[model samples]
Structures are given as structure tokens and as C-alpha cells.
Target: MDFLTLDYFIKLFNIILIDLVLAGDNAIVIALAARNLPKEHQKKAIIWGTVGAVIIRIAATLAVVWLLQLPFLLLIGGVLLVWIAYKLLVDEKEHNIEAKPQLWPAIRTIIIADAVMGFDNVIAVAGAAHGSFDLVIIGLIVSVPIMVWGSTLFIRLVEKFPVIITIGAGVLAYTAGSMLTGDPFVKGWFDENPVMKWAFIAIVVIGVILAGYLKKLSKNFISINEQGQLTIPDSIKNEAQIEANDSFEAKVDDQGRIVLVKVAKSEG
Candidate 1:
């Protein structure tokens, strides 16, 4: 099927799926980077941070796709993907650290951190799109805000409807399967038989499920408390409180890194 035909839509859908599927970390990073700012600056931080993220993502995707044209590069990408998958399963901690004061510095931190932490996403999206720039741009533009604003919503949905996570995992696995076929080592068989393609898809799907299940099992060993509000975490609660005392009726921790402790109005 030529990319100019109906397959274009399929490719576009796959690219968008890849973007949405991989956007959780981007949202978290943006939220965390801006979380430390005074409530007044949160919106600005998010806007600037998102702009930086979008720019960086486009550049990264373009660069990766360009490099993908090289001989044996797909094999290297495939190896990198294994590491990416392992990291996805094993690395649960957020990568972007909280920034201190100052707007540009925080924004810079967000961009840099996103560049590093988001490399995997870039490669994954590029591979899924299979060299379609239109699909890449469309996917990124459409999904960025959804990732930015709907992160909490996504989390809530995933929790309330556990199947959402399962479906997402399945998608990741399917992408991974497609990626494996494009690798230099396996590229030969990819065009040889339709059965091979289906088999690759099955393997990726099952691998992702098994890996996700193991990760879930690991989380079961840890205990997490339920919080009432979507406030920040405790580690930075005092800082936010101190900052909150100075002005604005309510502060937004744009970075979303801190765990907030709700203070009584009378206490302040």
C-alpha cells in the first residue's frame, strides 16, 4: 500500500497513537518543572515549557528520521528500543528535577530535561510514523495539549478504567513489533511473508503485557497513600506554603512535582 492512499490514514493513526501513548512523561516533566514557581508564573511556565517541548520534539523527530535512512541504523534503533522498553518497565522515577526560582532558568531546565528524557519518545514516534512528516507534525500538534492538560485526566481514567492501561500497553507492544520488523536483522523476512509480520506483532503485544504485568507486580509491594486533592507532594509543601503566604489567594505549582499539604485558612 502506497503512503499516498488509504494507508496514509493508517500511518497517521499509528503515529498519533504513538504520540499519545508516549506523552505521559512529557506532561509530568512539564508539570514538575513549573511546580516550583509561584502560582502567578505557573501558566507562563507551562506555555513556554510546552513551546520549548514542541520545538525540541520536532527537531528530534526530524533528526531521527534523517538518520534512519542510513544503512544498519534501524538495527541500532532496535537495540535502543530494547533499552527503552527496559527503562519503561524498570525506571519508575521521574527524570526532570524541580527548578528553583527564576522563570527562564526553570524554563530552560524543562527544555533540557525534556530533551534528555524524551528521546525515547522521539524515536518511538518517528518509527511508528515510518518517515511521514505530515503524520509526525499532526500527531505532535494534536496530542501536545491533551498531554499537557489531560495528564491528570488520563491518570484518573487509567485508574478508574483499568482497561485503558491495558489498551495502551497493547498499542505500545504493537509499535514495538512494527519496529522489530524494520530492524536490519529482521528486515529481510518482513517482506517475505505476511505471517511473519503478524507473528512480530503478537510477540510485541505479549512482551509488552508481560513486562507491564511485572511492573505492576513490583508496584504492589509498595504502599501509596490516597490524597484528597490534586495538590502537590509533601517534600515541597513547605516551600509552596511559604510562597503562598506572600501573595495570590491560591498558588499553582506548575511543575507539579511537589506534594501539597492543605493548610487551614485560619492557620495561615
Candidate 2:
């Protein structure tokens, strides 16, 4: 496919979308792994970890065409993708952020977790790429920074508006179902009966909702920083909210949670 064509652009978009959805947990893992390192070392860990992850995903994507050629492999991957989507919707354990301040260990942890957890993500990206590895490479290159750096913002958004997470889960479920129907073993079956494709999608969507409800019964939504390792300082500097000329006072608890934030009176 030509890089400048509309079909290629659409595939690139899908690849990027799949990566972002799959990257939320990865961002958290990176943060937790690097939290204990010195500030400079933390940066290094994120850089190297991201580099390693990108390389690993690229290599995996490159092998997708060959791997998918094996009988039943696509079906097995689709089943795994459904399970991963379910876990993404429901898993809520707070990762232990306290660790030795060694940088290499942190980087290793990030890489290992990323490699293990990225199976479904890699599958989704390969499906999106549609055998065009160039699209996969371009998409990952654009998305790695967002996954590495924008995790905090994405976490906060999910907390504030949980529907985002639900939508994300739905997207993953759709991908799983799509892959299942497209698997070569069953592709002929679905191709003959177009309605069966939508039926599989409905089944996957129902599965996601049911699994989420059951998991919710045993889980509680807590602040991401409930362990006190993550902190948010209350400071605002914006054109409409608070200018650089303005001052503010922030009240932080012992756990570093911001309890109050208010504009301070100017002291002449």
C-alpha cells in the first residue's frame, strides 16, 4: 500500500488507536517501575524502557504475517485478545511503586512487563496494519511518547470520567471480535454469513459487560495515588485560570494529596 493513500492513512489511524488503548497500563507500569529512581535516572529508565518496548513491538509486528499463517493461530490470538480486554476493563490492583533506586532494575522491570503484557496489543496492531509493517512502525513511533509521558493525564481523566475506560474496553472487545471473525479458519464461515460477524461482536460486547460487572462487585475505585507514592501539587498557570503574576496557596496532606487550592492575596 502506498504511504500517501487514504487506505494507508486509515490503517495508520487504527494502529495508533489500538496502541493508545493498549498503552494505558504500560504507562502506569513504567511510572511505578521508575518511581523510586533519582529524577535523572527516572528519565533514563523511561527513555530506555520506551526504546526497548518500541523495538520489541516492531519486531513482533514484523513477524505477524508469518505467525498468522499457522492454522488456528489467529483464533487462539483472538481468544487471548478477548481475555486481555476483559482484564483491561477489570484489573485494578495498585502496583507497588517502592523499589530499590537502581536504574537498570527499573528499566528491566518495565521492559519485561511491557513485553509480556503486549501480546494482545501486538496482535491488534498487526491486524490494523493489514500486513503493512511500515504503518505499524510509523504508528508506534508517533504513540510511544504519548504512552510514556501522558500516562498521568490519562489516568486522571479515567478517574474523573470513567466512561472513557468503558469505551476503551468496548473498543478492545470489538477488536477481539473482529479478529475472531476474520481468522482464516472461520473467515470463510463468516464471509458466507455476514450476520455472523455482527453476532460475534455482540457476544464479545456482552462478555465484556458481564465480566466487568462481576469484577466491579469485588472491586472499588480508589485514587491512583492512594498509596501516597503519586503526588499532585496544586499549582495553576494559565492564560484564563491563573497567570504567572498571580500567587496561590496549596494545602497538602501528609500523604501529599492536595486538599485545598486557592488564589492568594497579592502582598504589596
Please report the candidate that would top lDDT against the real structure: 2
**How does candidate 2 fare on TM-score?**
0.70
- Kindly list the per-residue Cα lDDT of model 1 for residues 115-139, writing each as its tens digit: 7877877887777777667777877
Q: List TM-scores for all candidates, in order.
A: 0.71, 0.70
As a whole number from 0 to 100, the lDDT of residue 137 in candidate 1 is: 83
lDDT of each: 0.70, 0.74
Which structure among the candidates has the greatest TM-score? 1
Minimal lDDT window, size 10, model 2: 230-239
Predict model 2's lDDT versus the native. 0.74
lDDT of 2 by residue, 36-107 (tens): 999889889988988897898889877985686576877776787788778777775456554548998888
